[model samples]
Target: MKEKIKIGMIGLGGRGMGLLRLVILNMSDVEVVALCDRYEDRQTKAADKVEEKQGSRPFVTIDYQEVLSIDEIDAVIISTSWADHIDIAIASMEAGKYVATEVGGAYSVQECWRLVEAYERTKIPCMILENCCYGRDELMVLNMVKQGLFGEIVHCAGGYQHDLRDEIAYGYENRHYRLDNYINRNCENYPTHEIGPIARILDINRGNRMVSLVSMASKAKGMKEYIKNEKSHDSELAKLDFMQGDIVTTIIKCAHGETITITLDTTLPRYYSRGFTVRGTKGMYTEENQSVYIDGSHDHYQSWNKNWGNAEEFREKYEHPIWSKFLEEGVQGGHGGADWLVLADFFESVKKGTQTPLDVYDMASWMCISTLSEDSIAMGGHPIAIPDFTNGKWITRQ
Candidate 1:
């Protein structure tokens, strides 16, 4: 029998609690041995869930360092707020534990470098828990690209297009972190969700690297307008100033002759989507419409008939091996079963002592987008070079 990989969980907010619940439900190979959060209430809640699911309460504490100090924990899942990710991940790695951290862009390029250096110094595996890489549709597109359907990729466009006015404006209700971030930061704060999959498809930090990027932001009017119209005209948020733009668009150029456009549209009023769009010499795929178009696959005039081929058909044919296995057995948790897979991969990598699929270099490169974009935006959309956290090794780092 495979040995159980003892685990510690930090930060018991919604995202953290959601992942802890996923591990309890789906990951029998993992043992939730420790639970930590800054709040006693969250710690109690997580401890209760662990006991209810596993029939035993974990070692609970309000301090994350206590969880890290435990000797039995083989790995830790850091689901802290955006500003705290790098610090927690580096600490976990330095404590001789593998780490799986939640998705969010880094606050500064220096912090990203610190994360990279921590992994380098410790030789500990660290994965950014980019659950979107396990999304069924996203994986199917990746498989098709691997199979040469989207030949010689030219460009891709994606975004966090969710309408998050209420969530950001009401951050105080649940002690959520977005309110202050939106009020102060002027970058794509949550970029890893869309960029993670795109980076894999683009083979960033493997064969290609992001060369430079430019960013622009619309005026910060959405939250104030939303508060006045939705909450109250005289609400305190309506009188406060916000730095985040209603929509921030960034364009990235890759070393291997590819360009990516990332649009951050969360603060606005729009239907939720990642807007996964891939264009190549031979074909194109768009997640918003759930359709794909290949050159010469359809009649030239038929393309104008609004009946593009459905993505479901492609999913049936080319579901990723991971999703295929889950479909045959079962799938659980949020993000269309992605959360469970992300945790499963983390646990499995820990058990096997193998390099995580979303390794440290990918973590640094993907997370640094926010800081780099911030610089670009502040410089009036001037280009900013993305650091190669792989240390000149991406050219041969397969």
Candidate 2:
């Protein structure tokens, strides 16, 4: 077994830096040997932080290829822009480095295929860092589903329903990538956060898979209204026409007769929520209310108002083994300790030289939702066929 996992940290943006500070730096068994970003200042800042923590500065470079060229690096953590993720991941895999890419949707189906192709060619494991999949509530629900609490799940719904008006409006000032996407494209631009956990619950790419989907986007008005109302934002942003809609709803049909609905609702005003929900023949779990309702266990009609937040009551019995262990070990890291859990899972797989829990196929299928939704929305909400990136292997992936 490897004594230490040498890592190359790519994309020194807010997300990248946060993961570095909150998760990677804290892992005693991991060493960041290299850092890369387009911007020099970001690279310098990250180097300084790593030096402060580890008493040694990482090799900093503007070109990500330089980081890939390092012989000692065993894996890479890609937290770059949405457009750059697949290319960087493909390159990393080709370099024989295990890959853990931060979550984002794909720009095109072809690029998604290239990710799968690269993994197949290199035989290097690539994992999507979908922190939400390891979320405590999500895992508890997943365990409940697996244990037959929510028997025969028929439908699942989730959404990225956080208001990002300020972030989108000031992206240029912050040097963030989301502003350009909002101006040029309209689709379910960010779907993985909500879809990841839901897909796992539905066993997508294992026993079931998303076969087709149709998406509809509401009119783009949130950014314009926010820019117009907020005088602090760049005045030029008010005049620019934004293509991204305030709300994008996508319905995905699975091969197993289950349907999944995911909504992209970042621009609108709302409290943060994935709005994760599961419905089955026996019971249901709803994140909005933090409640789980099981048939024959609770009053079906009149007692729901009293059952709000009752999922906590079942935690001792239904908590996922992972979370049960996590609690015992003490939760740490961002997103309610999900960040730590996901990174740990990836590193464990790397150490063991085993397949990732969420492999390239999962990344391809989930990320393609954005591109496929774009096509569906462009064609007046016509359903588009989802590509089987697994090449018929999903039938017996278990």
Task: List, residue by residue over 113-218, the lDDT tens digit for candidate 2.
Answer: 9999999999999999999999999999999999999899999999999999988887987899999999999999989998899989999999889999999999
Which segments of candidate 1 are over 4 A away from where they belong?
Answer: 303-305
On residues 211-248, what C-alpha lDDT tens digit does candidate 1 reach at each position?
89999999998998888888785467778989999899
* lDDT at position 53, candidate 2: 99
Candidate 1, residue 3: how far the Cα is off, in Å: 2.3
Q: Which residue pairs come into collision in candidate 1? A: none
lDDT against the true structure, per candidate, is 0.88, 0.93
Off by over 4 Å in 2: none
Q: Which candidate is the best by TM-score?
A: 2
Lowest summed-lDDT stretch of 10 residues in model 2? Answer: 230-239
